[model samples]
Target: MRSAVQIADARANKPGHQIYAGRARAIIERASIALRSSTWVPIATGFIEPVLYLLAFGYGMGTLIGDISTSAGSIDYTVFIAPGLLATSAMNGAIYDSTWNVFFKLNESKLYQGMLATPLGPLDVALGEIIWALFRGLSYSIAFMLITAPLGLVPSWSALLAIPAAVLIAFGFASFGMAITSYFKTYQQMGLIQIVLLPMFLFSGSLYPISVYPDWLEFTIKLLPTWHGIELIRDIWFGVIDFSSFSHLIYFLVMIVLGLFFTTRRLRDLFMR
Candidate 1:
């Protein structure tokens, strides 16, 4: 009887209740507002910047820079850089949605508190928020593919796979970003993420090949999941898909799982305090 009571207490304290409909619904509603208000603005805004980079830099200046050799073989500088941008876009959009949006609601709106009153828990909140990010990430992804389609950038019907790839990328970033959020007390805290993320984007071979990076810099960049994601997307876009795709797939998968584990644990701690 004591063990049973202790188990029940533990369960009640942990927010691990099954069927968290209320929490899911609330998260969906919040996400819906972002979608309805922004409409295509998010897609257009996110895609245009990268497209412009492709135009002015890829086709324009990349043409002057000429073809570059990759282990994936020789390709235009634009072709090489375009897919890396896709990875960054996926990371950027999802991180923005998860970290700040989740942070504000968790720390400020007391959104989770209200939901917990109805049987929802921190894991539900974390998972639901990630779902929202995935939905938005897919939209941006489809828009990105549509925009790039005319450029003949897609390498296969499997190119359709990129949309879900973006979602996976989003999950990895969003889960980890939300994990980081539990430690934050204010918006100023996120400046460090921005600082870290920007340099990762700039230096992780998104704009330039990592091969061009010095050996030490190259080693550190490769250690990041974003680099693996960038490489995966690039291979698909450039028609280089092979058995090694599984490694990248595993990279993002492990990242999402690990991140979620930490995020939920952290959120639980924050709420307890």
Candidate 2:
């Protein structure tokens, strides 16, 4: 038999103990079931959209724009934009998975309601949904990298690091997106996501160098998560690993923590109430 002190410790730990293991597994299992019922068309479509952007801007417009200067030195317009597109794709995939899909599950299908009725709690649901978003984002990132590699866009083997970097980006955005989604009670609020994401996509140093912007605007863009992601991916693609690279990693890690904190707190309030 366990000692009284040991039993008390076990009981105390039991409240949230399963969150890191069992609850997460349950959430993932739920996602897998939903994915099995879904079609591949949407996945194929997501992969295609980024490729279209690369073709349109990287090649079609590259002819007119010529070479661009980057921290990695002057490079073809296509080469410079390619990694940024990969970052964009990862961001888009994660946002879509976490926001709209999660909204529908939270509100329409009442999915989280059902999960909360089980042994699972808000934290489990939050993590599971974010992991699923990361899964979708990673898939898109891998496909984008494969396409770019043969085209000579990924110049170094260090580009393989892009996969985990993409996951970190996705985790940050997905958690952030989920946290935002939790506060929204109506579909009309979702348009706000577009308003925010579109500008970040355009101005986050993804399509153009931040040097084109004034100092204030450039500093603001650097604060955006996607800009850090773009810079991180660009560095990995060019084989430039340094202290700044680790700083980008830290930025995303911090975002992920903040996102999870807000998401879990919001979910508990929304559901527990």
Candidate 3:
């Protein structure tokens, strides 16, 4: 009953559709091996930095700042900052894995070069690295949330939504980070990443509300991927669901698409050529 055009289209797409199947699995297996070799100490240690910030700023600085006002209503200063920390945790974890770990594998280790010798292609490597980064970032976000829960920072059941939101934030950052790192030929270039990331972390309404910024600056901050990420987690933590929350989701989704496009293109250029 199918038309000739439909049959032709299906036949044309078949080979391309199979490209991701076994190849992506092979790349993920490579990631699993790397994960098994990694030490738990460093992973555990990463949790400490964010917790320290939460305690120092939440409790120490909270004494002076007291409660803060948000769209969700008035909240303890510590609680107000918790979701922002979660966003930062996701960003930090993803960027570290995608940039440093990926650069090491690509350049010094020549891991991806070996990967290309197999049935896998550039897209598989790109996707596998991204998945691994998301896994690491999500782990950090979950640990931070667990630490926050006992402190009475998470008031709403909606805090559960934060897991997926954190994953999305991590995905956007990891993909974007990998795409950017593909252009770097030296370790010294990694320092430049901090120049971009630090400002986004500090000024993206993470420590304070965007309303306090100048009109132009506030508009610029809102356009940042991290700012949208922070707002998404904050809104979920406070149980504030609305159109803006969906808009934040859309922003990260766009980042993921553009990032993947660039990453796959760059990887092919680097490894396949």
Q: What is the full ranking by lDDT, best candidate first? A: 2, 3, 1
Model 3: residues with Cα > 4 Å off, grouped in runs: 1-22
Native-to-model Cα distance after best TM-score fit, residue 81 in candidate 3, in Å? 0.2
- Mind giving the per-residue lDDT tens digits that candidate 1 earns over 1-273? 466445445556444454333355566786787677765665566656666767888878887898888887887787778788777778767876787777788888987677655555667777888878766666666777787778877666877777778888888888888888878887789778878887777777887888887899888988887888788888777667787777888888988898778877776676644
Candidate 1 lDDT score at position 73: 80
For model 2 the local lDDT of residue 9 reads 53
Candidate 3: 10-residue stretch with minimal lDDT: 13-22
Q: Model 1: runs farther than 4 Å from truth?
A: 1-26, 37-44
What's the ranking of the predictions by TM-score, best on top? Answer: 2, 3, 1
| Residue 221 in candidate 3, Cα distance off native in Å | 0.7
Task: Tell me the whole-model lDDT of each prediction, alpha carbons only.
Answer: 0.75, 0.86, 0.84
The true-versus-predicted C-alpha distance at residue 64 of model 3, in Å, is 0.8
Query: Considering lDDT, which of the candidate structures 1 and 3 is the better prediction for this target?
Result: 3
lDDT for model 3, on a 0 to 1 scale? 0.84
The number of the candidate with the highest TM-score is: 2
Off by over 4 Å in 2: 1-15, 18-21
TM-score of decoy 3: 0.91
Task: Name the 10 consecutive residues with the lowest summed lDDT in model 1.
Answer: 13-22
Candidate 2 lDDT at 103 equals 90
